[model samples]
Structure formats: structure tokens, C-alpha cells
Target: MKKYFYFLFFSLLPFGCKDTNGKKPIEITTNDSSSIYLNKAQNKNTKIADKLKYYKKSFTILKNQENDSITRSKLFELTKELYKNNFEREFLSSVNLLTKLATKSKDSFYLAQAYRSKGSFYKHQATKDSAFIYYTEAEKILKKIKHKEGLSLVLINKSLIQFDTGDYTGADRTLNNAYLISKKNNEIDNLYAISVMMGLTSLETKDFDKAIQYFNYGLEIVSKNNNIIGEFNKETCLNNIGLSYQRKAEQKKSVEDYKKSIEYFKSALKNKSIRTEDPELYNLLTDNLGYSYLKTENLDQALALFLESLKIREELNYPNQIVLSKVHLSEYYRQVNDTAKSKKYIFEALSLAKKEKAYRDYLNALKQASIIDVQNASTYSKEYIRLSDSIRNVEILSQEKFARIQLETDEIIKEKDILEDKNRSLLYTFIGVVFLLSMLFVVRAQRARTKELMFKQAQQRANEEIYNLLMAQQDVIDQSREIEKKKIARDLHDGILSRMFGARLNLDSINHLDDPESVKKRLEYLNELKEIEQDIREISHDLSREKQDLINNFVSITTNLFEEQTATHSAKLTYFMDSSIKWDLVKNNIKINVFRILQEGLQNINKYAKAKTISVNFRKENNELHISIEDDGIGFDVSKKSKGIGMQNMISRAIDCNGKLDINSSKENGTKITLNIPLE
Candidate 1:
């Protein structure tokens, strides 16, 4: 009987607690389902690993295959999948391969795809600037090719980066572009992401009702799609909706809204798809739910949920989330009249918040401490108010930054449109002139009259070209000045103002404390202020250095042109400028004309001289600026090409600068050009 009972127990163990192999059954609990979720996640990761292995093998094989459009497309798809799977190194390798193949084949489609993939990689790595750059490049190509879907995708990615960088208005504009393309192409996924980002921006600006509507729209899309990823997005929408409700509740102090927020959070948490795919979201929902519970005065449930949120954050080792959880826990203890526990948790939170520079949490802790400690309430409240004002100012500054970005983007778009229109008008005018000239030539073939007319036309064209060039140069100079001004403004706004604000807050806090630690903190802040002053001096020095560089702009331009000439042509170049020449004293028109002469001369050399060696010289002699260029090549006969357009232009440029030009060239002796301009 004893043996039979033991056998029965052992046999029933597989169905009861232990499996046949003696391992415990996978347990699912309402309080903690982390183990089961992790197991499922591990299984999914294993599958991803297997898929990555297959992809790697296939990628290697495809690399050896013929580099055709179809083959390249397959490779890009595989690389994108690698990116999605978080195979970062492998994705980069594949991107490099695609880039090389595309460049070698001159395939724009593959190149655009490669850029998009690179952007996705950077996006995954959270390098917003680089990701934005690559996405912009991809968008340029896609727009050129009129690839509607690809353009929409790239724009969406760019908008996401803009959102991350706090360019909320700019993000909205970018998303609008993507929205139009996606709507035209019926790209549901792209539209879904755009809606969510729009909602997030609205949420950030406290447009709760608008945010809720956007979230609901996104949720409706996911509901229609009904895939695993769609379900995950649905959960995200729900969570965001809950967040909006929670904000509304705080504003209105409505217990009903808080209860609604808790319900939504709980519903989002119950979605099994989110559990494995986004554990961080799970933690966030839990934390928000805890806050909602606290607002509703459900003390026991709030405490339990807060502890759970803290456990998840601790496991993830996310400092920000952990600090937030601690703050909530401290608030909970305070509400429950547990003074000792509240003080302990508040102090812990304060330390972490200060270390993280999370001023909001730090201020919250100070307020709580003031209430509990009583003796320091006035000091704590004063510091809290000061810090609050500083934070509000910073928020205003950030909003202004977003507005500035929006304005800049709008200006760029307007400028682009104006340029396009100008180009179109020029094209139409050119066509009309060509038609008129053809009729004139057909009707009147008198050679001398024709020659006179042609000369007058050429002179008119040259004057127009010169006027346009000067205008462009002036515009460039103005733009550089504007950029410098903006840089100085940013330094003041982001660096000096922020540091001074921090110092003021610290000073306010110092008056309340008499401890050695407080004195030490005050000294540290003073040192920081000194460092900030030094930084200001450094920035001023940088500005001065830039001004000096601008003063030598002539030399800089000449050097850049020479380097470009040497890089593009087979010729070796030697260039010299006399150190004694005061470039800053030269009039702008003189400098521009001299630069143009050099440009025309070098262009002529490249086209006609076939130069193997070139030399350029600039100097001042007898209160006159002297410039010369010489080339050792099979020089053209200057007598035959004396009336050439290039030579005429060079002479005209010199004349415009109140200078004289001399050209010496022969087939056997090579070529040399010289210009002399009076300094006065």
C-alpha cells in the first residue's frame, strides 16, 4: 500500500506541481508574471538568433552573387531585418556592403535604401542627430525618384528625431509632409506612427483633449490591423490616453478621471503582447497606476503597486525610473502619516534626484521634507519656489527653442520655393530669347549689324552675371554674421543663463542651512560660477578668432580654390601670398573681382592649358596689389584666343577692380597671367 501511494504521488506530480523531467511548471501569477514573460522573451530571442544566423549566411551568399537590382534589394531587406532584430554589428556590415555595391553600380534606389537603413540603425542606437542626417539624405533621394512610400518613411523617421530633440513644432511640420505622402500611398503603418507622434506632441503641450483624440485614432488603426505589433501599439495608445487623463485629473482634481486613468492603465498592463515586448512600458503603466491609486486615496493598493514598480525599475537598473518610484513611495508614506519612513525615502530620493539633476523630483522632496520636519518648512518652501520659477523659465526657453526651429524651417522652405520659382522664370525667359534670336537671325543676316548686336548682348549678360555673383557673395556674408549671432545667443541661453539660474537657486537654498555640508555646497556653486565666467571668456575669444579669420578671407578663399584645383586636376600647384599685404584694408569689390579673376584663370588652365604644374602669386608692391598665375603646359596661342569669352571675362573683372591684366602664353613657352590693382 505504501509503495502504491508513492507511485501515485510521483505519477501525479507531472500534472500537479513538477513536470515529468522534475522541473517546476511555468507559473503565472497576478502579482508577478515576470518569470513567465522572461521565458517567452527568451524563446522569442532564440528564434531571432536563429533567423539572424540564416540571414547572415544568406547575406554572405548574396554578396558573392551577381550585383543586380534584385540582388541588391534582397540584401537591403535582409539588413533592415537585421536592424529590427537588434543585430547592430551585422546590420552595419550589411549596410556597408549595400553602400559599396550601390556606389559601384551607380544605383540610386539601393543607395537610398542603404541611407534609410543606416538611419534606422542610428535611430535604434538613440543618436538622433546622425539619424536625422541620414534620414534627410534618404528623403532627398526618395523625393528625386518620386518614391512615395520611401519618402514617407524617411520623413516619419526624421520627424521622430525632431520630436526627440524637442522640436515639437518642427516635428509637426515634418509629420504633415509624411502624412500627405502616406495618405496618398495608403501607407497605414507610416500614418499610424505619425498619428502617435502627433498625439505625443499634443500631450507634451498639455492639449489633453486633442491628445486623446489622436491616441484614439491610432488605437482604431491598430484595432483594424490586429497583429501582434498592432496589439502592442494599441496598448501604447491606451497607456498614453491614461497619461492624458491623469494630467487632466491633476488639473481638475477630479477623482473620477483618476479612477478612469487607473482602469486604462490596468487594461494596458493586461495585454499579454506588451508584457514580453515592452517590459519598460509595463513598469511605466504600473507606476502611473500607482499614482492614480494614490490620487484616489487607495493607500494599500497604491503602496503595493509602487513597490512593484520599484522592483521592476531596480531589476532594469534605470536610475530615473527608480528615483521616480522612490519619490512616489515617499509621498505614499507621507499620506499614511508614517513620518520616519517618509523622511527616509524622501532623503534617498533627494540624493538620487540631485545626482541625476532631476530638479523636479528634488523640489518635490524638499517640499515633503519641509512639511514633515516642520522646523525647515520656510526654508524648504522658499527654495522650492525659487527652483520652481527657474524650472518654469527653462520650460519657456525650451518652448521658444521649438518655435525658433519652426520659424527657421519655414524660412528655409520659403527660400527654396523662391529659388525654384526664380529658376523656372529664368528658364522661360531663356526659351523666349532663343526663339526671338532665331527669328532675328533668319530675317536679318547683315554680318556687321549682327556682330554689334552680339557684342551688346554679351556685355549685358556679363553685367548681369557680375551683379548676381556680388549679390550671392553679400548674402553669404550676411548669413555668416547671422549664424554667429545665433551661436552667441544659444551660448547665453543654454550655458550662461542656465548656470546663473542654478547659482541663484543654490544661493537661495544656502540661506536656510548652517551645516558644514551646506557651506561646502555654497563653495562648490561659487566655483562653478567662476568656471562659467571662464567659459564665457573662452567663447568671447572664439568669437574674436572668428573675426580675425574673416579679416583674412581673401587668403582663405585663395587657399581653398588652390586646394580644389590641385585635387581635381593632374597639375601640381604652388601658391604664395605676401604676409605684408593687409587683406582687411582691401575693398570688398576689389577682393571679389580679384577672386573671380583667379577662378577664371584656373578654369582656363584646366580647360585649355593641360597644365602639369601651376604657380600662383599675390603680393603688394609700390602701393599696388600684384597677382600672377603661371602654368607649365602646352600653352595656347594667346593671339588666336585673344577675344575668347574666358579672357574677356578675366579682363573685365580686372577692370571692375580698377586693375589692369597682362597675359603671356605661347604653344611652346606655357602660360602666365598677371593683374595689378592700386591700393588707394
Candidate 2:
């Protein structure tokens, strides 16, 4: 009954957003009887729809069910279906529950998969920072589990995000990681992805021939396969190859390159049904081909193609593509000697480009403005040069970030990033010096005013850059601190190695030539000896158990932390413990929370407190245990309104244990933090 109504509703109701959607409306269809909704949702053959009714049903079922491995598998499928069907709200909602359930199930494989899915979600949202963080998380887990394919996919995702942010050098290194993984696995799909992305990186860096070669390689792989993936790759390779040629022509004005570009564009659009099948690509191809025709003096053909694409773009209401169409149309008019029409279109294109942030189109408009608007040519030329130089500097900064590429560790990336940052700063200084020398003789009256402003701006920029760098490096710094904890755990290997070897030797010794009575007696003796040995080991373990409890272990841990911290700073650190405090009687939960809070405090002090003396004390008073930390460093206002995660966590931890916590700080008096947990 629902199926009959689903088809009937679409037939009777008006198609939604037909003019602006570009793609045709989704047809009501089923891919499979079982998992029908999910299957159809992920089906490219069905176009796209939210299918909120089915989504809600899935979410309801998930909420009622136990979050076991089977449930996790089902949830993961729902996320995929939601993502593929363009249900962003539901996808984000589902991803959190899926990850939490995976974590609860204690399944590393599914947990890694969940994190990667989250990264994909954020990537689609264009939230690169969150996406990168999640991908790094997934990378750590997948690497530990030795899941090559999952790691490869995550790296590919990270590289794509890097490429989007203009981090071409990082993208190259990241793709190299995926490439190595793909080569090891001998997976054609993964290889195809790497080759194409590498081509894009090369293309962006202006290595046109290398880019073309990569596209050809991708094309070769697709031609030998007959899957749906191949069809998609074939079109992508054709368009990307065409784009590489188009860019080369734009750079060098090579007539042969433009001709080659036209051929590829025509090839990509050879299937006549593409206009209806994929109107978006059809529009892009038409616009690109028109531009190539305009470049080659085929004015009549160029004008018709431009008009067709322009009509399509306006109907589709894609402001970015509309700006692109207008830019191309302006060029067509300029080539035809229609100066007024060219001016009109270029000005409109510039306005729309600014509104849409279609920077490439904006540049094109500016360039055309300089040519067609003879009276204002100097102004347009100056604006064009300034924007172009700004873009170039941004690109340089991004590339310089990973100039010393080492993909082995986050530490390497951070260390190399800092080195490149210094290099970039020096480069800026050198450029500023050159500019200053050149400007010294340029209208002496304005030079002093200009220099002063430049100095102030430089100081501000330096401060901003420093803050941004610190924020970006926070994750890597946290990872380094975690290594300290792992270092302590790794020491256990030495104690267990000899015992494991002895046990293995005893197990391997079999009495092959013995009489039955003698073999049985020997086995009994061996079992008795093993039981005695285990009993001895248990006694030894229990004797040391108290020393490994949360509080005692914390004391030992903090000793190492304090020594390491003070050795690197000028501050003299002192820690005193109340010997009368009975840690064995206190719950581990309270002890763990206190330990974490102290760690956070020490970190903050190391980062922001330029203290000469730091005091950390744990004492018992009245009917409660008291802990206080005092640092004679520059302190912030106690009454300031802000969102600080560290402070919130400390307060929450104290509340969790029915404790009272207070923080007192002032600029003149430094800072003090106190915590009181009741003995009851």
C-alpha cells in the first residue's frame, strides 16, 4: 500500500525545485526487497532523497535495541545510507550514537570504522578541522590494529581535505602514504584514487604533463574494468585531463593545448544523453568548450555554447557557475568587439563573483575589465595584481608547511611544520626589507607614515600567527605527553619475558619414549610444580597491589612529570604530601579525577604561567582532604566570563565526588586553586 502511494504521490504532486536542482527529481524505486529503503537510499541509480520516514524508523529501532556488535553493524549501515542519500542532519545524529556504541562494545575494528565515518561526515560538512582530528584518531587506531585498507581510506580522506585547504605539500605526502598502502594491497580502486589525487596535486602545482600522465593512467585502469566505479572514473579522468590542458593553455596561451582541451571536453560529452542524464556536468562541459572556442576565434560556435550554458546556469540558480558563465560570456563579447556588452557582463560577473567568493571567476573578470574598460585599465590591473599576489602568498604558505615531508609520525609533521613556519617568517622579513629599501625614495613625506603602519601591522600579524600555531600544535603536544604514560607501561616486558620463555619450554617437552606409569607420574609432578609456581606469583602480585593503586601510582607518576617539567623551566617546584592521608580507604574514582585535574593545572602553568616558584600541596584538614596549588605567575581574572574546558572539567570532577573546589586569581597576586573532598 505504501509503495503504491509512493509512486502515485510523485505523479500527482508537482516536482520540487526542478529549475534550481539541476539534477532530475528522484524516481520512487526499490533496489531490493530486504533492506529495501537502505538499499535504495544508497543507490546512485535512484538519484537522492532524505527518506525521513525510514530514517526515523531506523533510529527508533536502534534506540530500543542493545548496542551489541550486531546493532553496531546495523547502525553503521544506517549512517552510510544517510550519508549517501544527503541526509546531513540524520547522518550527524546517527554517527555519534554509532561511535559511542562501538566504543561500548569494545570492538576496535568497528570503532575505527565509526571514527572514519565521522571524519567523512565532517568532510562533507566542510569542517576541515574536525574532519582532520577524527581522521587522525582513526589513523592511530587502524595503525595499531594493522588494518591497512581502513588506514588507506582515512589517509585518502585526510589528503583530500588537505588539498581542499591548499596544503598541496601535505596532500602529496599523505597521498604517498595511501599509495604505499594501495600498492601493498594491490587494490585497483585505491590505486586509482591515489593516482587521480596525485594528478590533481601536480596540476595545482603547475606540473601539467605529469598531471596528464596520471589521468591517462586512471583512464587505462577504468577501460579495463566494467564496474560502476569504472564509469565514474572514466568521466572524472576525461574532465580532469581536459582541465589540465585548459589550465596549461591559460598559463602559456598554447594553441595546441587549447585544441587538445576541446577534444577532451567533446570526448567527455560524447554521449548525447548526458545533457539529460547529468545536466550539471553537461553545463560545465558546454561552458568550458565555449571558452576554448572563443580562444580559437570560432566566435559563432562560442556564442551559441555560451548562451546555452548561461541559460542553464541561470535556471539552475548556481551563483558560482553563473559567475563563471558571465565571465566566459564577457570574453566572448570582448572577442567579438562588442565593448559595451563586454563591459556590462564583466561588471555583473565581478559583483556575483565577490558575492559567491568565486575567486577564479573574479580574477577572470578583472583581467577582462582591464582589457575592455580602457579608461579604468590601470585600476583594474592594480586590483588584479594585488588579489593574484595575495592568492600566491597563501598558496606558498600552505606548500611551505609540509616542505620537509615526513609521514611517519605526528611529531615529524609538527616539527617540520614549525621549521617551515620559521622559514616562512624569515622569507617575509626579507621581502619586507626589500620593500622598505625600494620605498625609501618614493615620496619621502608618506614613507614615515607608511613604515609606522607597516611595523604595527607586522606585530599584529606575528601575534596572530603565534596563537594560531600554538592552537594547531596542541594535538601533537598532547600525543607527546601520552608517550610518557606508554613509556612507563612498556617497562613491564622485561619482567615477563623470562617467565614466558620457561613456560613455553616446559610445554614443548613431550615424553615420547616413556612407559605409561612413568609418563603419568612425570605429568602429575609437572602440574604440581606449575600450581606451586602460580601460587607464589599470586602472592608476589598481591603484596605489590597496594603500591600500584591509583593514589600511590599517581605520586610516582607526578614525580616524573614534575622533574621533567621543572628541568625545562626556570620555576622551582615543590610538592608535599600529608603522610596521614589514607589513600587505600579512598575510592579510585576520586583519586583518578584529582590526578587528572592536577595534570591539567600543571600543563596550564607550563604553557601560560611564567612563574618563578610553583607550589603543589596535598593535605588533610577538618573532616575532609584538601588539595591546593599555588603559582606565582601572571594570573587571569576570577570573574571573567568565558568557556574554558579545563576549568569546567575540574569543577565537574569535584562535583562528581561531592567535593568543593575554588579558584582564586588576580593579575597582581598570581593564582591559587583549592579542592576539598569530604572524608565521609
Q: How close is candidate 1 to the true structure, as a TM-score?
A: 0.48
Q: How many residue pairs clash in model 2?
A: 0
lDDT of 2 by residue, 265-364 (tens): 8998887776886666678788888888888888898899999998988888878778778878887788778888988998999999888876766887
lDDT of each: 0.73, 0.72
* Model 2 TM-score (2 dp): 0.51
* Model 1 / residue 199 / CA error / Å: 1.8
Across 1-680, the per-residue lDDT of candidate 1 in tens digits comes to 01110111112111111111123323333232322332343355467656666667767766787887656766665665566567878888988999999889987777988887787777767675667667776776667667776787777777766665556777788888989988897767767777777777777677888988888888888888764223366667788889889988998889998988988899888877665676677778788899999999998889999998899888988766777888788889889989889878877877888898877668777877787768778988898999989977765665565456446655666787799999999999999999999988976877766798889999999999999999999999999998677556544543465456657766786779989988987898899798778768877866533233435687886787788677546889999899998888988767756765676777667767878899999989999999999999898777787575556656766786788999898897899999999998
Worst 10 residues of 2 by lDDT: 1-10
Candidate 1 runs further than 4 Å off: 1-68, 85-90, 100-106, 266-279, 315-318, 350-680
